[model samples]
Target: MKQYTIGKKAAVIVLHQLCMILMVTGVFATGYAFRHDAHENIDIYTLISLAGLVGSFVSLAYMANVAGRKSEDDYTIYYLPIDKVYSDVMLVIFTLLMVFMGKVISGVKNQHFDYASLIMTAGTFTFLFDMAFIILYQSIVRKIKGNILCTHSLMYKGYELLKRVIEKKDIHTQKTKEIMRIQEALEAISEGALDTTLNVNEFHGQQKKVAEAVNHIRQGLMSSVNESLKNEKLKADLITNVSHDIKTPLTSIVNYVDLLKRENLENENAKYYIHVLEEKSQRLKQLTEDLVETSKITSGNVKLNMQKLDLVELLYQTGGEFNERFESRNLTIVTKIPSEQIFIYADGRQLYRSIENLYTNAAKYALENTRVYVELEKADTKAVFTIKNVSKNELDIVSNGNVDLTERFVRGERSRTTEGSGLGLSIAKNLTHLMGGKFEIKVDGDLFIATITYNII
Candidate 1:
């Protein structure tokens, strides 16, 4: 079963219950003072103080409950009239009953029913005020069904203010700037906004401004993402056209070279030249295929057939495939596998390619004879796959310093000098995302680590 910590929520609930009691007591005191004669010197102001204290406490409870509800419940359910409001209404009724009793007591004490009508009126007024708020909230959103949800929904008023700025704007220019500012403020607030308290008027004003700013920023980001997608399509098309043009002639050239060798051009000098040409041609073909596949992945045209697979087995198979390649560079693959089958959901082929890229990348750029460490583990309901390799040079890509360090083809300053198309990590990153996981690369000194995590439970 899903569960939530009852620490703060339980506290608020207790506070709310206490406030309800105080509110009822305050109502009775106020009514008693109203029914009393002016000459009695009954010190009616004392009742007023109790009422003030009760109202203040209740208001705090309401605010805290609202904040708690918003955190745990869906925004759409926030406007729903829940049991908490009904419970509050019930308390108001109890307050009215107590006030009526207080009136009778005061009347008996003062030996007069002269202020009876006034006491009843005061009781009626307090009851109506509490009931009206309870009824009015029902006309909006419903909150989630749980103690936690009820508490957070109390902040719906603040959320609604922000929602308005985003949806009900007229002038795009003013609205856009406001939305941007709101987003900035929200970012700051998320960083520490709740800790800093402010009055309703000041807080709501700031909230509206932040909401407007956020709306503008959201629209702008969406537009930018669309443009980036279009540009990627264009890049893919260019690569496609270029590949066709280059491969057609190369295919014929290779066929003609074979024919030449068949015609006794296999002499020492002729064979040496032919071998060089064949190697260069094969290298170009391999590079072209990599470019095409990488482009397809980037343009979001490739689909992966995913399934549940054993993580340790997959890693072992991938390492074996690259063993011959890495052996030439004196690179070693050191793996630390637990004696248990770690299962994960992913496309086996894509996962293989991703890991292969990491190993090959290490072989190409890592220091000779260095071991590339591969480890698998299950922690916190996630399957973690980590690959660590040596870095020969400093990485030089600056993607606005996002710090996740997995933004596509970013290589170390030293690795950039090696022969690579720089699309290996980018493809791996996208593949991880498609597989419902995260891919992250971190650089520490001479070591570069690629980590992938997927939820297994």
Candidate 2:
């Protein structure tokens, strides 16, 4: 079916009205001719009238069947023979036919001035009204909302406005729907949707191009993420292997160094060298073990054993081990813990380690003769342990400065004069979180603070 433009429809309306008028004139003229003589020979006027009747019927059928109806390319089951646009046109045509029929009947029966003239006059007025009605119908089509096929199919009144506009699809319409589908897929992917695939087969031209591009990007992203994860796993495995390899040989060296110390050899320099060697080897072993443990905590490889314990007692116990070292650094430990026991549910080993890290960190770099404040108290539903001290080195603390320190190998001391592998805080923080505790650290100039909060039992 050809597409109907406004100009084409207007042409159709004009032709239909002219056909109707001619048909009515012919009908009246033929009726009068036959009425005058029943057996008159066939004349040119009668032949001309017959042709007009045939042409009128053909014109009526053409417009009634095809005009304003959708050209559906897909299979559909339409229960109604006539669609909305044609139905209204048929109603108007029927009403006009009845009006013309009545007037023609009157003119035929009346002994009026000229019957042919009266019939033509009746048709002239009818065709005028017919043309006006068709124009009004075209005006109606202009007011339908965007996307008529989706909205106007409820068998309601005034749906004729969208009757001619509705179609299964056109080239532009198919392209629009495909473009929308592509956009929907893009949104889903951006929000981390993984399972759904776009229907590239349904699209054409640029829509298909867009869908394929998105699919390719998604594949690339998944590949990149997987590759990154694989590389991280290999790095973690390498750290574990290196730690184990160094520890095995280091254990023998430490044992031999201690054995040599037990010998009563009067060689002072050899004994001192053995002591230094033992100390340096032990430090190296501790650093390697810390690296491996940090990896395990981060990767969730360590199993936890949760139990109820007094948080205040645990803090005092951790502080005790670091007391001699704290005094050596000229730092005094000050406790502000509640006298009442505050119990919490946590993995004892990991919790103790987290606390030890904070105390050791303070003791190692706290300003000499300054107090390292260790405070434990109840805040809402949590038992909070806070450690604050004045840092020895000139510190540059900004927003996120202390938070970033929890990353492995990030240390406050640039040259690492103090004995630490920099994995202490990272392991402590990760293990704290794994055991359902919150660890936070803050640094303001020389003041360094670490707070660990656990849910009270």
Query: lDDT by residue for model 1 over 1-457, one digit each (tens)?
Result: 2222456545554454444444554455544566654434344545555665676466554544453244544332343434455434444555776677567545544554345554454445544444443333322223333333334443655566677875665335554655455555557655744332222233345566555555565556657767987898898899877987888887887787777667776479888888777767766776677777777777777888989988888878887888887788788888887877888888998888877778777877877778878888888899888988876665553323444444544555534642665667877888788888898888776678888898874
Best by TM-score: 2
Off by over 4 Å in 2: 1-214, 340-343, 396-403
Ten-residue region with minimum lDDT total, candidate 2:
74-83
**In model 1, what lDDT does residue 216 have?**
62
Superposed Cα deviation of residue 4, candidate 2 (Å)? 68
Instruction: Write one digit per residue (lDDT tens) for candidate 2, span 1-457.
Output: 4544557655666677776666656656666667777436336546656676676566655544434444324222222323344434545665776687577567555655366576667577657666655444332332131223323344434454454344333324666678767877878878877554777787788888888888898888788878988998888888988888888888988898889888988889988898898888888878988988977875669999999999888877888888899889888889998988999999888899888888888877788999989999898999889999997776544433544778888787554654788889899899999989999988777788899998998
Instruction: Specify the poorest-scoring 10-residue window by lDDT in model 1.
Output: 194-203
Q: When superposed on Cα atoms, how far off is each prediction in RMSD?
A: 15.9, 16.0
Residue 445 in candidate 2, Cα distance off native in Å: 1.1
The per-model lDDT (C-alpha) reads: 0.64, 0.73
